[model samples]
Target: MFKRNKTRRRRSSRQRGPVARAFFFLVKAGVWFVVLSVGWVLLYKVVPVPITATMLMDPNGHTKDWTPLSRIDRNMVDAAIAGEDGKFCSHHGFDTGAIEKAIAHNQRVDRRGRGHIRGGSTISQQTAKNVFLWQGGGYVRKAFEAWFTVLIENIWGKRRIMEVYLNIAQTGIGTYGAEAGAQRYYRKGAAKLSSIEAARIAAVLPLPDERAVNGATGFTRRHGNTIAARIGVVRRDGLDACIYR
Candidate 1:
């Protein structure tokens, strides 16, 4: 009976055409992808993420201290929302308005051949990219970003997303996270970061290498100041209510 079953299985395998084999292979691959991606998201929900693709790929050596959200200052959260994603608490991963605005802004160009390029990525999207995906843009990356964004928004929740973002986000050249950035810039911990310090770090987040947090000048300084002022508004207006609640 065993030999008969084995012979039948072998015969079935031999009968499959190239197209049938390819379809089965794709189906198996897709199932594995969903299972692994979902498991990854679930695992990170409670666990402090150990590492990411971006961290390993950085040419400059990375420095990071994985401080939980409780250890990080509230002002830091406020500053991030203010500086990066105002609708972080309200939106479900993506902000269509910001994307539309960015598209419009990027479309407008002056006499030069080069045009201004701006991104509408939110904290959720950034966290998605920082954690599950790689750096840079392309349709493929964008699709993956959208997939991971949905996974995190559904699995990790707002607070967890914020915690991960604050911890993993590149704060400066080779420096990662609020804790490491605080120590590098202020010789202090993230828990003790002031509004200005937090805002400065948040301001430099988008282009950490280009912006200076220690003595930010020009656009960096101005953006930091703006975020600093908006921090209070974030708290007052409950822009960070989802996380707090």
Candidate 2:
């Protein structure tokens, strides 16, 4: 009987070994994920991001010149906020209102079989994507984007988020960042960009490789003007209070 009991205990221990190992492995992975995510966020908060997947994939190669938030003109900030995310400062990471609107619009277009239409990604989401993830449209990529967005919003804060966005966003085909955009397009520093110039640059953000910032015309010109007009509205409504302060 004792021998039988000992044999049963040994069998139970063998059965539990794999489960215990798996549990420990999962715990270690979770801890590492948190540590690495927070570490990267904190590192980029001060150090200029050297490269990103977008920059690498661009045929023109990376051409980024990092500029601090204080160095970049307020007009550029206003224009970016107005054009890309008017409610940036108000929302935490995700903009549910915009997401709902986008979903409704996409559904309408889909019903007509007009293909995918419109994107409601806010500046925070864009920053999260541009900085951490690759460019694509799939559930997997989007899930990771959302995860990173939450991480940055909580770990990096609003100001750091804006700062990184301004510094890493692809402005032109080869150019990246506000400084590079301002220099390449306007032959001036980012801090010296006028409201109109800034708006023109901001207009190209949706399609940086396709849009022309130097000789603004047609759609770019009109969009720039619209964004320029909305800048004041954003300011007055305190939509940029999070970073402006």
Worst 10 residues of 1 by lDDT: 107-116
Tens-digit lDDT string for candidate 2 (40-111): 888887788889999888888888888889999988999999998988888889889989999999999989
- Taking the candidates one at a time, how many backbone clashes does each contain? 0, 0
Model 1, 145-197: lDDT tens digits are 99999999999999999999999999999999999999999999999989999
Each candidate's TM vs. the true structure?
A: 0.95, 0.88
| Best candidate, lDDT | 1
Give candidate 1's error at residue 243 in angstroms: 1.1
Give the worst 10-residue stretch by lDDT in candidate 2: 12-21
Q: In model 2, which runs have C-alpha deviations exceeding 4 angstroms?
A: 1-14, 17-24, 113-116
